[model samples]
Target: MARAGLTLERLTLEGAELVDEVGTDQACVRRFGVKVASLYLHVKNSQELKTGTAPLALEELADRAADALAGWAGKDALTAFADA
Candidate 1:
């Protein structure tokens, strides 16, 4: 059962990881009973689950980009961020 206090942000991040590992189609609410129930405690349904995953991926990408760009400059930062 869902703990009731879990936030959508947490679930979204988890869902995104799950999707990346096993593909988004397998990350279905109906396929993951506990995850589905827990996720629904935050999001309305499967579509919203995917919606949540998008921002999580973007945030991760941005964080990686920042880390790659840190302490770097000119072509180095540009190439690192771009390659990342």
Candidate 2:
């Protein structure tokens, strides 16, 4: 039900930035310059947007952890993961 110019990926990225700026409490559809009705075409609501964005952030974190720990061992890997 997404609009022609909008997609879930774009909404998720924008939602993530909104969450960063004002925390989840203030990341509303208006922040993305879209009508509430239009927003609902892509996401059921603000909570759904946040839900979709969460896994993207987690995946990015995991990738960074993997890269940071690539060839390190033991304490070094632990330190790298922690630092990442």
Residue-level lDDT tens digits of model 2 in 8-81:
77888877877778877245566667677878887777777878888978988999999999999999999999
In order, candidate lDDTs are: 0.73, 0.79
On TM-score, the leading prediction is: 2
lDDT of 1 by residue, 27-69 (tens): 6454445554565666787777788788778998999999999
Identify the runs in model 1 with alpha carbons over 4 angstroms from their true place: 1-11, 28-43
Query: Which residue window of length 10 is worst by lDDT in model 2?
Result: 25-34
Q: TM-score for candidate 2, please give it.
A: 0.68
